[model samples]
Target: MINNMNKFIAIVGSNSNKSTNRELLKYMKHHFQSQAEIELVEIKGLPIFKKSADKFVPQEAKDIAKKIEASDGVIIATPEYDHSIPAILSSALAWLSYGIHPLLDKPVMITGASYGSLGSSRAQSQLRQILDSPELKARIMPSSEFLLGHSLQAFDDNGDLKDKVAAQQLDGLFKDFLQFVNIFNQLNNAKEINVQKAKDFSWDKD
Candidate 1:
């Protein structure tokens, strides 16, 4: 049995108050209470990222980075915006990566919700590539994705997933993420090298 101490951060990749992606993450936090401690984080109100010679990292971004650094894993719920992720989420990532590598080599689970049937498929795919980039280098849970289609109708009034099959799928994927966290932590062969490489990629270099 997995320990209850397995803490995770679930990032709501939207700025809107009425986001279905946020709703989906809330459901997971309640449903998986026995398995892990999932904290919901918001990307709202972060300023747009711009390259600076001073390598300024916002206090908000640094605070979020500290949370991520202390957590065992991360979960991101994204909504599709024109076949991609929202600009706010993209900017949030840029802030997280600039001179700060909290997500580097972190275990991550990708989930998405959409109003249409495709269920944010394109956004998730694009997110994968972004996470795989050198600055991010997140160890995303392989071969596992939870896509919620018609998400407006997916959950009931109590904020629980109404579809049994989709709920079961999320259960399995979350369990896999727990194991992925344990396994990733065991591989320390190149941990130091990876960290140095991420730090070296900073624009505030000589």
Candidate 2:
């Protein structure tokens, strides 16, 4: 019964105002409130990362990156479009990956909802591979897949999940993710401290 108020940001991958994926993210954000301060985000405000080399990135994209960097962990909730993530989310990831790895060694959780029978499993898989690339190297949570299939009927009018099983799964996923993030952050912080100490060590003869 540990209580840790970690800050987290949820990224929604859809541009549609009526997207079920967005609603799914909202529900997950509320469910994680007890364990974290979760803020749901969207990529609609971010512009395409690159048109030409060394072009100025928009302030909106920078703002989103800042929020992600400030947070303890990240949750990416998206909708599968043609067996892949949507363009909006892709663009947002591009912005985050520009010139540097925004997710380097950062804790990341990925989930998605879709109308199809497999939900967004394919999309999440693709996202996982992308996050695991040497360039990004995000510490992704494993074995806790939160894929909500048949999402059109997965929620009630109030946007809360209707399936008790799904709710339970999400609860467990959130808890596990929180623990994972905490452990990783602790280790990363310790490493940073050691590195700082090493940098300040005196090798000169006084």
Quote the lDDT for 116 in model 1.
99
Per residue, candidate 2 scores C-alpha lDDT tens digits across 70-115 of: 8888999878999998888888776676544557777999989999
User: Clashing residue pairs in candidate 2, if any?
Assistant: none
How many Å off is the CA of 89 in candidate 1? 0.5
Q: Which candidate gets the maximum TM-score versus the true structure?
A: 1
lDDT of each: 0.93, 0.80
Per-model TM against the reference: 0.95, 0.86
lDDT of 1 at 3: 60
Each candidate's root-mean-square deviation in Å?
Answer: 2.0, 7.1
* Model 1 ranges off by over 4 Å: 1-4, 202-206
Looking at model 1, report the run of 10 residues with the lowest lDDT sum.
197-206
* Window of ten residues with lowest summed lDDT in model 2: 196-205
